[model samples]
Target: MYVFSAQRRAISIICIYMTYPYTTWQNCVYSIDRR
Candidate 1:
């Protein structure tokens, strides 16, 4: 159970790391579209 929980945490961290940049890029594009 502990290992499973650790894996879940790692996946969550990786997902956040991956999404953070994409989300920022999306926001940047959205702002550009507004201009």
Candidate 2:
């Protein structure tokens, strides 16, 4: 159970980094530029 919890924590951290706020900010900029 401890190992599974650790694995899930690692995966969550990875997912957070993969779709980080900076990437979303860049997408927002592109949309603003289109205006």
Candidate 3:
């Protein structure tokens, strides 16, 4: 049970972090595309 909970916590953190970096990357791509 402990292991399962720990894994869920790690995945949720990574998912949020993934979104942060991905948005930055998308903005960079969009700016270059507009030019």
Question: How many residue pairs clash in each candidate at the backbone level?
Answer: 0, 0, 0
**Pairs that clash in candidate 2:** none
The window of 10 residues in a row where model 2 has the poorest summed lDDT is 24-33
Over 4 Å off in model 2, which ranges?
1-4, 22-35
lDDT of 1 by residue, 1-35 (tens): 13436655565556566678676544543454466
- lDDT at residue 10 of model 3 (Cα atoms): 62
Of candidates 2 and 1, the better by lDDT = 1
Write down the lDDT of every candidate, Cα atoms only. Answer: 0.54, 0.53, 0.54
Model 3 has an lDDT value of 0.54
How many pairs of residues in model 2 come into backbone collision?
0
